[model samples]
Target: MLQGEEASFFVLCDGKTALPLGTAQDHKRVGEGDTGPNTGGMGAYSPAPVLSEAVQERAMERIVRPTLREMSRRGMPFQGVLYAGLMIENGEPRLIEYNVRFGDPEAQVLMMRLGGQVLDLIQAAAEGRLDEVSVAWADDHALTVVLAARGYPGRVETGVPIRGTEGLPRSSVQMLFHAGTALQDGTLVAAGGRVLNATARGTTLQEARDRAYALVDAIDAPGLFCRRDIGWRALGPVQDAPATSQPT
Candidate 1:
């Protein structure tokens, strides 16, 4: 098995031009430090340190451009978000998959950074005018920790009342997003394996992570769980060794 960090890059394409929108790394495993069984995604952070501007540019020139070229050659020019899932080892990127939509928790972190830039990008791409518009991303980092039901990626106990959603921070820097939730009898309850997303942005990845964790800790959902190290890979070092993660 090839062991390395995983990342995904997002781009808005109009068959003639591809507009990049940065990248993100996600925690795939259900436990800390990439331990336990693999899950869809436990948490995520944006501006993955591994996918630097140089690497992103290389990916665009090498991967994204070629793929779009091939699609056009086949008379199927892509005209929307083109997502690339990659495994990076020794600073070289290897393709894991290609998605036409946003990556899971990876999208959460990027959207936190992108904000309303999404609408503009989508409109431009849909109209085949991507070159006419540009994405103005903030020089900031974002982290999102998924709050899952106690037994996620397995048998999950649902209908558990979730508290602490009231009076929480909901600003550009910090917020909570509900996923698999339902309101019964005027009470919010967990309705699926993954429940909420505690997300935040900051000047640095560490600061965003701290703010996200604070939001996680404020929740009173006894049936929920979250991974503590969302940005471990980007932050450098695990304990004795370097951190490796995925988009996972």
Candidate 2:
């Protein structure tokens, strides 16, 4: 056993991606480029525009519904949320795995998209009234980027001074949520593998991506690094776009 008592793991099937096309990637490390051993997820985001509603509906029919039925038949009676991690390999959706809980960075993005009534949705799920609850997504697309410690998933140097978080426009559709923050003598300090989630909601995925990167620029931390091309794979060509420019 890998002794994941303090951690959690999920099983992903290769064929799940083929049901109704969607692509997802896991944040396997506390740093960039899949380097180092896995941590509790430095961050994640999803609903790549390539994953159309038709595809997601197919996944619900072919994968999620059937899996739930099978689990119930086997007496498992799974009742919590399911994270179906997936990836597109050679234009085909492949199941990366299944997670029993919400993905970290992914959760932040989803929650931001879910907006004000998140508590209500959870309650409905718990009460088996999911049918009665309908998700009203904002017309805008959203993205979340994570900031982590330098040596995260390992021995990290904490308590570093962080700055440049004030004066953000309140109506700018951007939010900075604290994931691993601690107050030491009334000063906010980094405390975990992933520390802050900078999220933005916009009229489209490209717009959301633009806003997200803008928020990243406002932060002044040398130890922080975020994937500049978060939703690029799904949103389509932004290869040569400048980091500070807003997408149309």
The best candidate by lDDT is: 1
- The local lDDT score (0 to 100) that residue 192 gets in candidate 1 is 90
Q: What is the TM-score of each candidate against the true structure?
A: 0.93, 0.74
Give a tens-digit lDDT track for model 2, residues 1-248: 22110111121222222122122333555433444577666544545553556545655666676887677678766665667754533333345568766677676666667666767766666666666556565566677777776666567767865678776544447888887778788767787767788888788777777787787788776665555555544554445644332111
Model 2 pairs whose backbones collide: 12-97, 17-93, 24-86, 44-105
Please report the candidate that would top TM-score against the real structure: 1
Residue lDDT tens for model 1, 1-248: 66777788888888889999779888888977788898888988888888988788878888889999999999999988889998888777778889998888888888889898788888888888888888787889999999898778788989999998897999999989888999989999999988899999999888998899889888888878877777887776445321222112
After superposition on all C-alphas, the RMSD of every candidate to the true structure, in Å, is 3.9, 7.6
Model 1 compared with the native: what TM-score? 0.93
